[model samples]
Structures are given as structure tokens and as C-alpha cells.
Target: MERLKKLMVGLILLCLFISCSQKNNKSDGKLKVVTTTTMLTDLVKTIGGDKVVVTGLMGEGIDPHLYRASAGDVDKLSKADVIIYGGLHLEGKMAEIFEKLPELGKQVLNVGESLDKSKIHFIQENTPDPHVWFNTDLWETEAKAVTKKLSEMDVKNSGYYNQNYEKYKKELERLGEYITNRIKEIPKNSRVLVTAHDAFGYYGEKFGLEVKAIQGVSTDSETGTKNILELANFIVQRNIKAIFVESSVPKKSIEALQEAVKSKGSEVKIGGELYSDSLGDKEHNTDTYIKMVKANTDVIVDALK
Candidate 1:
């Protein structure tokens, strides 16, 4: 009986020790960083290396424009050691909430906000374009800014951040080259990108394509029959091969245009859904900015070619 009691006591102590060790391991893991978009989260993951645990608040195909911060999201934000957002009012309704995060003493990094004011094209003079990721070269600058913020947050991991940032920058440069080469495959005059909205302006500017949309920059912009008719007419007149539907926005607008074009005896194919305002599934390659751009390029090439 005495031996059995001793064995039980040893087992209990072992279990307690294991439990405490797991708790400490979790505590020592890394600083929790939450980003508004998958692109930002991926970049943070690269720069932060093993020193940060990054998560995207927006999930696959989730529209940042229409996104509302849920109670669970708030709880996530509250627990984060640092939060990163694409800024430039990309979050739309959630903008005010993010603006208040710094007031709560949480380190908030608005990486796009560091862009040169002169380079940014705004919906209004005060509101900058949030689609910086579309311009891969420009995104490098944003990544550097993010790297700086990560270093500031965890100075001990500064060396790792710097090393990783350099590696990430090279990858971005490679992606830019690949996009340039792929876009070149499209006939010069056929290089027109028409979508539900003006989300691809940066993309067009970067890749030498003419871009047009029925709605303006914001998905919240109202569309009317006249706008639909106008876009259909333009598509038919230009003989553009494809029009893309955004993953976040409704397809009704694009469908209306397609029907209008068909009535005019011109058939413009609907290009596969594009990841404009959000990333692809986390398990997929397009879940990050680099992969998102590559996915878009592939779809665009397939449709246009």
C-alpha cells in the first residue's frame, strides 16, 4: 500500500511538471501579431521569422470594405502584442475602430500610411489608395516599413527581421519580374483589364494594361443601369476578351454587363474570380501578396491569351 501511494504521488508530480512546462513553452513562443489582411500577415511572418505569431483577421475571400470587427475579432486584437493594417481606409467601416487601437496602447502599424503622399492616388485628396499590394515594387517599400515596425516591437529579434526582410525583398523582386514577363504575353493592344470596379488601377499601371471598371475605387460605390450599359458598350467596342469578377463583390453587376454585350452580338467571357481585396485560402499559394499577384497574373494570362 505504501509503495502504491508513492508511485501515484510520483505520477501526479510528473503530470504537474509537464503541464507547467507546456504553459511556459506557450508563453515563450512569440509575440502575437494580428494583421487586417492576409498579405500583411504573410509579410509579418516573413520579417518576424520565429519571433512572431501572425494571423489575418480577414479570411479567404472576405471583403475588407464590408468587414465589421466582431466581438471575437476585438478579443483577438486586444490580445495581440501588435496589430498591422493595410490602412488607406481599406477597412472602410472598420477604419475608425483601428484608429482607436493605438489609444488603447496596442502597437498599431499602418504600413501603407508611410508611402510618399505625392505617389498615392486618393479617392479623395485625404484618402489614399489602399491597393498598394497591386504594385509589387511599391509593396517592397511597405514591406520595409513593416520590417522597421517589427524591429521596433521586438528589438531582440532585429537581426532575424533584417535577414528575413532582405530575403523577402528578393522574392518580391522575383515576382515583379515574373509578372512583367507574363503580362508581355498579352498582345499590346489587347492589354485591357476590365473588372467590377477600379480596384486594378495599380495593377494596370504596374503591368502596362489599360484598366476600367463600372464602379469607382470603392465597392460601396453605387452602380446603375446606365453604368452597366456603358461598360457593356465599351467592352464590345474594344473587343476586350475578358472581364473579371472580384471575390468580395457581387457578380450581378458583371453579369448584367455580360448580358448587355451578348444582346449586342459580342460575347465577353467572364474571367475567373480575381483576389482583389482579399487573399485566397490559407492553404493555397495566393493566400499571400506574392502568391496573390502570381495567381492573378495566371488568370489574366489565361483569359487574355
Candidate 2:
């Protein structure tokens, strides 16, 4: 571990040296921000507006749980005036890189860590579920955190950031209500969500749906055979008509589970895709955070209703 740490330090410092020369060249004299997940990137862009130049590390269908910072990502981070990311092990693979970033005198923010820690769900003793964005209320909280970060980074645009945060947070609150009403459309007894991984614990708790997943909180963890058997039994026993596949995770696990149900003389539909760890592509309806939530809710309501 010590050797690995040294190697990472070496890599970060080297990138810092290379990026230091590019600091003066902003796209339009904006605060350059680097974010981890597509959701965070969108949130920051919304909050920062025209005052900030935001670059996202993870793109559409990119899994933050298993994402490692490439050489180019490090260079981006080094050039950034502020670095922000989704916390709570969502970017578990890049934890070391995030940790080392602060030492380079760059303002680094873990957007999710600003919330009341008690509200966070722990899948294990130290492992908290990192999909806090699924809960729109929590997303609102993180938006304010982003507002605070942007204000600090570019004090001149503090008012602009505040205005945007207020506007966006309201949208998130409405989104929470929208999801609630949509979930209600599903008969109460059928209010169960099964997905590729355990990314929706908070979503289930908030929306009053019982969520079951094949894998644990982090996608880095593997799905166990016993888990597959138990989850297959669950869908069969509950008469669940649909299970979901995440955009970022491979469909095979859920497909395998679907086959398991078939073996037990039942059929579970794929329903449709849900944007779990990341957002959808630019042309898709789920290209943004709000749109992504609505799209997922639409899929859930239509199939389960």
C-alpha cells in the first residue's frame, strides 16, 4: 500500500507540473471545475452556470464504483481550480486520487459529504450507499453544497451561483414529489424494486418501496450465487412482474436473474433501463439529472402499474 501511495503521489505531482502551465488559459476566464459523476457534473454546471467551466470525469454509462482516474483525468484535475466529486465510495476506485488532489493546493469538494451524515444509509459498517442523488431531497442538499463551493471558488459570481442553486433546488424538491406520486401509481403491494446492484436503498426508503439488488452497494463488489438464488426466489414469490437494469452496469446479471425466474416457472420482465450510477447520453431524454429521474420514474410507473 505504501508503494502504491508513492506511485500515485508521483503520478499526481507529474500531472500537476504539466497542468500548471495551462492554468492561465481558461475557456472564457471561468473557474475550471472537474467533477466525478455525470450527475455531479450536471449539478455543478447548473449551479455554476456561465461563470464556471466544468469537465466531468465519468461520462454516460460510466461506472463510478469501478472508475479509475486515467492519465488524462489526472491532467484535467491538475488544471482545475476546483475539484468536486460524489462521495461515500461512489468513486471508490478513485479515492486515492481525490485524496491526493487537495495536497496540490486545489480546492476539492466531496459534494455528498455536506449532508447530515445520519441520513446516509450504510450497506455495511463503513460502506455507505453512494447513490444519494437518487433521493431528490438529498440531491437538493448537495446542490446547495455545490453552490457554496462555487461561491467560494469564484466569489465574484457568488450571487449568480446562489440564484441558480435556489432555482435548481426547487426543481429537485418538485422532482421528489413527482417520484412519490409516480411510485404511488404502483399498487402498494407491488412497490418493490430489484436492480443490478444495491444502489437504490435510499430511493426505496424515501419512496416507500422495498428494494432488492443482486450485488451490494458498490458495483466493485461481485454478485454472489446465494444472492442470485435468494433474489430469484424473491421475484418468484412476490409475483414481481419487472426488474431493472442499470445504465452503468452490464445487463447480464439482471438477465441471469431473469433466466433464474424462468427456471422456476415464472417470467420477470426487464421493464426498461434505469440510470443508476450515471446519466444517459446527450440525445436521450435522460441526458440531464432531472430528466434522468423523470425517465426512471416513467419507466417504473409504466411497467409496474
Candidate 3:
């Protein structure tokens, strides 16, 4: 089945390359940008503005770790003038496809790879955490990188892109302040952020919370009974008020953890669903990257405070 899938992708790539070759210029006179995660999509859109057309492969509530690129996604990517993604294997299943795109002469940017290595958190040797967006300061770095990429691709509108970035930078600064103040509301001992997965490492590190998760960095990682029992014990001992469920991951593991805590004669509430891997839609007021971060912080602070 893996071989067949590869063959299909290969055939699709060939056809897309041919079709893309025939299109010498975009009729709309805008750079066509394709991004993997919603975070990158928002970044591109925020910087590119009217100068570029952006297409995001992943949507709200989608988990990038387990997201396999469909043929339709490949088609979109192959035709793009530039492709941006959160690298470090965040989009694990689509990594091979991303690798092949550059071979076909597509301009690709791995946002995570462009970061200063010293600022990154590694789960172990060479396994850097891909949840860098949760750290507002780190995310500002990514925003600057995205702005530079957009400017390079659309030189005519380089000034416009930089302008947008400067404006966005101020907003991010305000967001940083907001997060710091909100985090202060929670008592130091109660600043433990227990979630469904280890996606909040950056958030915890930046905001001074002790983050614990039932699963590892990737949602694809297994959640064994031993993991549940161990986490339950920690929660009980810490007297954690609430645990969070991720929008992209199933709540079963976290629900199971709550049950284990109950078995230990302790109680915990489900704080709220966090937008870890994806942003929420407009209905939830988390459609934009800034909004999503604010929403998640509000949820975490309210629960723990």
C-alpha cells in the first residue's frame, strides 16, 4: 500500500510539473503561496496581504502530525510559487512531499529550521519541539522570517510586506504583555498546565508553567495505561484544578486520565478545548493566529486561576 501511494504521488507530481510549466505567469499577478499548517497560513496571509495568494493545506481542528497530503493538496502545492511550512517534522506525514517539492524547483521555507537553535526546546537529542508558535517571542521571530520571505518573493511589494510586519509586531508585543499579566493571576503552585499532549512545552517554558501531558509531542504517539496512571498521580498530588483537551486530538485519553484521578479519590475538571494544532473557526473567535493564542491563554488562565 505504501508503494502504491508513492507511485500515485509520483504520477501526480509529473502531471502537475507539466501543467505548472505551461503557466508562465499568474493571470492575477500575485505570488501563489501554499502553506501546510494554519499557523503558517495565517503568517503568510498577514504578511503577504494583497501581494500574494495563499492556500493552506490544513484547516481548523486538523492535526498536522498525522496529516497526509492528499492528491489535491499536492496539486495545490506543485502550482505554488512559494511553499511555507512549520518544519522539524511537525507535518510528519507530508515531510516527504515537502522534500520533493524543492527538487521540482519550488521555493520552500521551513520556518522552524530558520529559527535560532539556542531558543529551541528538544524532547531529546535532535528532536526539537515543533510547537514553537505557542511561545509569543519565538512566534515573533517566525513572523519576521515570514515577512522576509514574502518580501523576497514579491520585491515590488516588499515595503508593503514590511509595513504589515511592523504593525503586526506591535500587536505581538501587546500580546506578550497580555500573556504575562494573565499568567500572573494564577498562583505559582497552580500554574501547572496539564493537557492531552505535550504540545504546550513552548508555552510553559515561556510563561513559567509546568506543562505535563498524557502523550508525547506528536498526537500519533501512543497513550499507554502506565502513562495515564502516572499522570493521574501527578495531578492528584499537585491538586491540579483542570486538564485541557486539544481540538485536534481526541478527548478520550484525557477523559481516561480524569477517571484515573477519580479512582485515586481526587477530582479534576475538563478546563476547555485548546487550539493546539489548529486554530478555531470564526464562530469561536479564534480564526486568526493572534486570536487563537489569546483564546488559548484565556482558557488556561481561567482554569488554573
Cα lDDT of all candidates, in order?
0.81, 0.87, 0.90
- Candidate 1 C-alpha RMSD relative to the actual structure: 11.8
Query: Model 1: runs farther than 4 Å from truth?
Result: 1-26, 282-284
Weakest lDDT window of 10 consecutive positions for candidate 2: 18-27
- Each candidate's TM vs. the true structure? 0.88, 0.95, 0.96
Q: What TM-score number comes out for model 3?
A: 0.96
Ranking by lDDT: 3, 2, 1
Candidate 1 lDDT by residue in tens digits, 10-117: 544344334333422347758788898777777888788788888779887777877876656765676677889988888886676666566555678888787887
Stretches of candidate 3 exceeding 4 Å from the true structure: 1-12
Cα deviation at 164, candidate 1, in Å, is 0.7
Clashes of each: 0, 0, 0
Lowest lDDT block of 10, candidate 1: 16-25
Ranking by TM-score: 3, 2, 1
Model 1 quality (TM-score):
0.88
What clash pairs does model 1 have?
A: none
